[model samples]
Target: MSEAKSPQSTVDVNTMTAIGAPRYGDGSVLRTEVVVRPNPRPDEILVRVRAASVCQGDAHLLTGMPYLLRLGFGLRRPKDPIIGHDLAGEVVAVGCEVTGFRPGDAVFGSVNSGAFAEYACVSAQRLAIAPTGLPLEEAAALPDSGMTALQGLRDVGQLTAGQSVLVNGASGGVGTAAIQLAKALGAEVTAVCSTRHIETMRSLGADHVIDYTTDDFTASDRRYDVLLDLIGNRSLRHCRRVLAPKGSFVSSAGAPGGDWAGPIVWMGKIVLANLFVGQQIGILLMRPRRTDLEFLAGLTAAGKLRPLIEKRYPLAQAGAAVQHVLDGHAQGKTLLVV
Candidate 1:
């Protein structure tokens, strides 16, 4: 561990190009503009962003969706205009109180906001050293999706080796990460995706690939010990039918039940249903941790875990990258390279 500020680096920290949403609406609201670069606080570090990923959460923030979200985001517009979370880059400055990292360290992790810019300030607790052998683009895609899958399966679903596990939406970012992580955990993994993505899922070590186009996994006679529902498209009853006794069902996504309620209504339904059943059912709200990021980075360094990147865009085209994700058809993670 080291402390003390290094000499002034190559990156200029005064001002930078950033993408911001003038108003909450659609992807169209995102605009590329020059903004003052962020300065790190006592427990923070300033990163010159090399790459950042577009996430479904970003789209939600962009639209101010479910109305209730507006409570935390903003009443009439976004509170923090610049949006993005996952980022990998070089540290250009370190706060005086920071230790174990200094200027010139390559790090990757999550942030509260402002990753879609040349520079971002993140809490020291949320970051870890980037993996030795991973590309910055791929590392940038891992934090949010990787931690979500890791916590959803291992912590929430309580997955055990040799148990049967099924992952829906197996081609998207979280789905792909879940598939690989499930396999790494020694579970019998089944993935559900479109016909075009069947091979990709299989390549990721899925024991079985169900083409949702031609098969209804819920209608099958097979029962799984755990079902990680990433799409949230099917009903709770339908999902329950496919779970074995004492199985766990984790809900991570779906359309908002109401503009004001968002996923709260659906989560309530799941909770009420769990009262009479032996099975476990709940929504997965990911708690990002540095330990989880380090674990995933080790897996990446060892060649056991890999991020699937679908496309890349420059900082100026960040809005388009977000639109690609909002389209609901991206095969993997989308990136905004600075």
Candidate 2:
């Protein structure tokens, strides 16, 4: 981690550049604008964001879809207009109540909002020290996707050593992280992805790789103890077909069904089906926490896990970066460098 830098002696603290959306819409709604720099609350810290990563959640929020989300996110407009989550940077100022961090400490964690900017105010509780020797961009990429993978495999799937696990959509940010994490947990990993990503999946420690273009993984006789579905394209019945009896099926992805409905209808269906089956069928809603961030940081520091960054965009091009993630072709993470 970097020592705290003295912003008072080195830089101006008035205004900063940030990406903000005036109203919920497509990526074009996002624009780079100058805004007043924020101050840390009594329990918060002011961070000069060096880097941040774009996630599917950010894309979903940009549209304010499912209308249900708007209940808490803002019915007419986002409650907080600035949107972003994963961030890695240096703390330039700490609130009086803050103790674990000081100015200049490099940290990585999720922000509730306002991360696509030169500076952001994050609660001390949401952050952890960045892994030693890890670049800010890579560290920034780890929090959201990495935590989702860890929680899904360990907490939801109950994956155990020597268990057979299959990761669907094995090329995206969460899928890549899941592959490595499942291996780290001693599970034999089978990754399902497109033809081009087979080698990439294998390189990430997958014991087997299936190209979805040439083969339907659900049609195979292979049975897995846990199926981590990052692509919700398949039906629940199809997914259950590949699961071993009494095994777990965790779904983390779904297609947008309706403006107000979103994936809730599908998730409800899974819940209903669970009543008749012996297998575990459910959806994963990833919650970000500081302890999980620290645990993942430890793994990264020990070289047990690493984030795969597919592209980097400067602050000025943040809109394009978000579009790339929305397009659903990025092999790993897309980062924004400040």
Candidate 3:
């Protein structure tokens, strides 16, 4: 793993510029320049990033999917020029009044800006300690995907012991975490992934693995109390066919399109239909927070939860890593070594 560079004597941290639109896939998005933003604000902690993960979500952000987001981000550019979401690093500087951290403490968190650089600033509330035995690359994969998985299963889906939960994108980042967390929560888990990934999900404790290429899961005779569609492919009408009575649906698969509209537009139908139907269609944004992160970290430390990192790329090769995620065959979380 690469260590983060210290702030230079002159105050410039070598940073990459997110100035260009990705013409096509990840290959077109290049990090070839350095930008030095003024040091972080008072409420922020500047971190020397040790490692970070390349998520599919980051790919969508780069591609400017969800057309609505561009208006706020930039008509043709990203508002946060340098983009990345999950980060794990040592604190290099802390603002006044910041507690629970010091300059050298190893920490992991999510932030709103520029995670792809050598140094990133994060809010104190979004970060938590990296477990002593955990690798920086592993812990870096936790915040966004991990929090989404845990929050989706418990808070959003209301998953319970003996309850059956089906995760559609069961081999991706959030899907991998959700499978383990659902099993840890005592739910009967079913995973939907490619045929090549069936055994992988089984190793993670999925009770059943349905290969989408071979057969359709929603077309199956079985029913689930919670249908978690991380891929966001199903329309409300199609999804309703598979839900059990009073079941809920939560979608994490973001769309690639005009502005920044989410799959919730389709989910909105699930909501309206629910008023007259028996099922309780559900959807909400996943917030990355310390309380939920600590729980995930504890699970990782104790062996109940683990990241299924399909691959790792160095900082220079980070664009390739993003491309891999954009290609959409990566089995789980993809990480970027500093």
How close is every model to the real structure, measured as TM-score?
0.95, 0.94, 0.90
Candidates ranked, most accurate by TM-score first: 1, 2, 3
Cα lDDT tens digits, model 1, 103-216, are: 999999999999988899999989999998988767999999999999989999999999999998889999999998998888999999998898899888999999999999
State the local distance difference test value for candidate 3.
Answer: 0.78
Instruction: Kindly list the per-residue Cα lDDT of model 2 for residues 169-270, writing each as its tens digit.
Output: 999999999999998899999999998888889889999999999999999999999999998888888999999998999989865578888888888888
Residue-pair clash count for candidate 1: 0
Residue range with the least summed lDDT across 10 consecutive positions in model 3:
1-10
- Steric collisions counted per model: 0, 3, 10
Tens-digit lDDT track for model 3 on 160-195?
998999999899998999999999999999999998
Model 2 stretches with alpha carbons more than 4 Å out: 1-12
lDDT of 1 at 153: 95
Error of 1 at 238 (Å): 0.9
lDDT of 2 at 279: 97
